[model samples]
Target: MIVFLCVRFLVFSFVWPFIGGWREMYAANDAIPLFINMDYMKDPRYFAISFRRFFKNFLNNEDLRPGIYELRFSKPEKVCVLENSVLSSERTLDVIAYAPRDLATENGVSFEKEIYVRGSAAIGQNNDLRALVCDGDVSLAKNTVLRRWLDAEGNISAGEGCNLGVSLTSGKECLVAAGCVFRRLYGAPVKAGTSRKKSFALAARDDEERVFPPPPLGAKERQLEEIWPYSDTRFSVITPNRLWVGANSRILGHIKTYGNLNVDDNVLITGNVFAEGDIVIGQFCKILGDIFAQGSVSIGEGSQVGRPGKIKSVVGNQTVFLSSGAAVYGYVTTEGDGRVL
Candidate 1:
């Protein structure tokens, strides 16, 4: 079943490429010209040249069309709409990648070398991602470790129970809030253990063992949150409310949440980011959202929250901490006494 699913998904990403005659349509503010074509003595840019070359051979017509050729324009008014339009030819697909720029490149794309930008970030990963999904309403907690990204072609929300600190690569739009913590950074192998402690040394090699990265120390998943290729180590839970505790605030008693969290106000939260695991948020944290950390919760200042919601505990070994001088305005929680300085 897993194998079948994998194959199906791989095909799913390109299924739209087969749509017939959708690319020839022209998009314009006014009616499309009865017939339109580009005839430039010289080439435009690297991308433009690539496009002309693709069309010349998209149907295996190497020289059927010249760098500047004539073609009929089917859809005119809808040219602007092509941002979300489907692909009829290779030109269309490359020009208008996805419906949502944040998810794909159907709208506007700025490419610098191999790096491409759709929404507010870039897409580049040097690791294994069976599949990264950022579909539907998804949010990224302030500091969340996204072992895998999702919905580069759909809407994915972020907030609450974030801060995993792992490498992140976007396919679509990855929403990140404030006061959230992401720990993972791509670079040298993390120094772990000591002479008297555990030690691990890794160098790039060619082998399954060398290729397979260690299981990520990812945080649990929160509510209303779903990622492609789920990570098994992170926490997942729903939140009801939160009592934020910042570095400049005071903390007391075990923290407990039933809704979501939004810390930022230089206040004190008597809870940790994770005590259980599962977590979720329904609020729109200006800076932060729900938290589902497994160890510590440290949010930045001015973290926001979503609608009326509370963060709940689902696992253990959790602690929610926030950055110094951070402000919170949403709900938060924990199960044991917490501290602030």
Candidate 2:
């Protein structure tokens, strides 16, 4: 009887945990709705290469054009533009354009979701394209209005008098000439002395310092500081090379560049700006963020870094030339001469 009792207790101890875990997993799986399994984008179909395959197979039809093509997403979202064809959409659903294709809107269309296109995309005059993501080139025609978050893997060229909202990102070159208004244009992020790489290293050091030295912050402040920038789940742009913003443009976001950043006249940036090379802000430019550069930084006349009356710009290992009538709201620190008129 004693031996039997001991064996039974051992069995219970070993088997109960396994049973509990299995039951929990089963319950979790059973609680999930069938609709989740049917979502192609959420299932195995959401892979990066899957997009290429899905587009290829779906665009197999010749002479594709504008029509209500039902794509099996969660609930058969409209595929406005067919494969490699010029098309237009009247539906309010976010439109997806495939590669080797051209897409245009008949009237002004607003997408609640981000527009995903494979090839070239053109928005008609007076139309608003919200949040666009494309692997190929993108062009904004005259008088077109582009709203939030435009990202392209290739080049982006905007015509005269185009209005671009915040956060334009391109993997290649970005050229917006005169009469174009923009906020936040990015070319790419590259290797540099103080770059994304340094950020990672610094973050690690901060972690170590937090444990050893312990920053002199209250518990709440320390917790909040630890959570910031990590818990903020906003989509950020990542590029590899250069960035150029035309005259009269405005950008308000955090920018990190591996190459040079050129801002034309009357530009305003309200966030942090870091460049690996030279940064030249043209006349009447306003930057409300901390500015750092690996090379020379030149602010044109009538420009202000940080807020007015306070200097918030810093240069690393280079000269900072603030022209006459230009002011940096925060103090300037540089390895070279920091001359401000």
Candidate 3:
């Protein structure tokens, strides 16, 4: 009995390691691998592109002419296709409407689904919409409420007291009137409370060769003692305290401030801007690069960020306010509210 017990113990000890190894290998093989592609999902036009693809594929399988029809998808989906322009006023649309030409809506219209217009689109006052995609220009009247997003291949104009929803993007210019609110905006040049012609005229009238004032005396003594270098621009300036730049001043380098930053009228900054606190930009200023603020940001009238061909960003952790005639070439975003005044 004693010899048998010793043999059993040895056998069990020798086999347990092999069994555990096998179990570990099996568990590894049973594990699932996950891959996530966030680029497409993060795109601002993701919904619009996806819907366009689906509609095109659906059209390919059908031989229906231009008219209103009930499409049978997983569920019954209503569709309206118009060869000529669409004029829907004081009505409710529960269908996905498509117009190869222009589209116009009157006051008190409610759109429950997406709309696609190959030509221009004019949305009237007091309208509620889900989404809109236009190949040409788009104009939204006063007090319109967009629930999802709006995208245009040409230009976009939103009137007063409009809610622009999650995202508003334009291929060319984007003009937003007063009392409009939005989350994200992207465009070649986004102008608030001004027309394209007027903005251009203002720019043209400004002195192209105007000289910028030199940096304030004893500026270096006031700045934080750290000298950070930028690889691309090779210019950086840092301040540990509140920063205030006088009118018509020019900063040839990037500015980083720990406290609030205030710039007076007609300032020109050649590089990026970073502020831990609130940032207030005065009128007719031009910032060549991005602006990032941990607190709220207020852009004064006629200020421009980024050049015509270049793209830049203005991002505020809190609210972002754009005064009349302010322009951002690429993107304007805020975690809280974004308003045009």
Candidate 4:
């Protein structure tokens, strides 16, 4: 019996690993597949879209008319539906407010729940809101504080000193005034303060007529350079220290810097920019690609980030600042606070 037990133990310990016994015990079908849907996760408008869909479905079934009504669902679930416009300035709404038509509020009003407006929304000064979604244009007066997100299908104009919490997105144009703070912004052209078409036009004209400086001595000019004379070359410029590109200079390739990157006024870069340190882009500069910085990123006035059709990104680990007239075509995000100056 002892001999039998010893032999059995030895065979189980030593031979089990070599015979693929563990694999047989735990079948492949027992393991669950792991998958993350990035399309749903990365969509900025997912919440707004879902909310609208649910509200539309509820509206189809409900028999409520064009007045303000309190809708009770299951236990503890309620919503306030406003069929017409809301132009009140006196009271605070503590429920989820849904307006099919225009919604306009006066000063000092507070909304503690989410607001969905199908038409244009004009919120007055110093109003506090949780979240706002509008299918048409939206306008927010000065000192308004949004605790969550704001989304609009048409143009969105936020007055000065507004705190746009979480994410602010616009399908067309997003015009942010000075002293406003945000975390993430997405738009076709998100402009700071106002749109400066003339500045971009002038910058483009100057780039066409401007003469490019020759490559430094002993520096090999590759065929991938995208400047006027060498518009076909594509290369990356890597540096250990800080890099300062002069004013009106054009670079067709990517730039990577270990230290801070300072770009002068009216500079045009056709490729992406990566900086380990802070990045400062001067006024009226045009960047055709993305901008990624480990440190803070500050874009000067009249600067343009991507073209009209292309989608680009400006991501900063720290704070991001956009001066007046600065425009970004796609997305702008910062882990820290983002301010429009």
**Which TM-score value belongs to model 3?**
0.78
Model 3 lDDT tens row, 17-85? 688778878888655668666664556566667776777677775555688877565687888886656
lDDT of 4 at 40: 62
Give a tens-digit lDDT track for model 2, residues 67-150: 656666555556555453443544354665433455555545556544667666766555676667677877766666776667
- Each model's lDDT: 0.28, 0.54, 0.81, 0.81
- Report the C-alpha lDDT of model 4 over 7-111, residue by residue, as the tens digit: 999998899666765675676655665887766667777667776776777778565555455544443445777754755675698888888778999899898
Which scores better on TM-score, 1 or 4? 4
Writing each residue's lDDT as its tens digit, candidate 1 over 1-341 gives: 99999888877766656443244434334556677456535211223234334333432533222122233223211111123322221122212122223332222222211111124322222111222322233333222233322222332333433332222222222333333333321111111111111111111011112212222334322342222221111233233434232222222212334433333333222234433332321111121223354444544322322211232222212443432222232223334322211
User: Which candidate model has the greater TM-score, 1 or 3?
Assistant: 3
TM-score of each: 0.19, 0.36, 0.78, 0.79
Question: Residue 317's C-alpha lDDT in candidate 1?
Answer: 27
Give each model's clash number.
Answer: 122, 15, 0, 4
- Screening candidate 4 with a backbone cut-off below 3 angstroms (N, C-alpha, C), the clashing residue pairs are 223-233, 224-233, 224-234, 225-233
lDDT, candidate 4, at 223: 32
Candidate 4, residue 183: lDDT? 96
The alpha-carbon lDDT assigned to residue 220 of candidate 2 equals 17
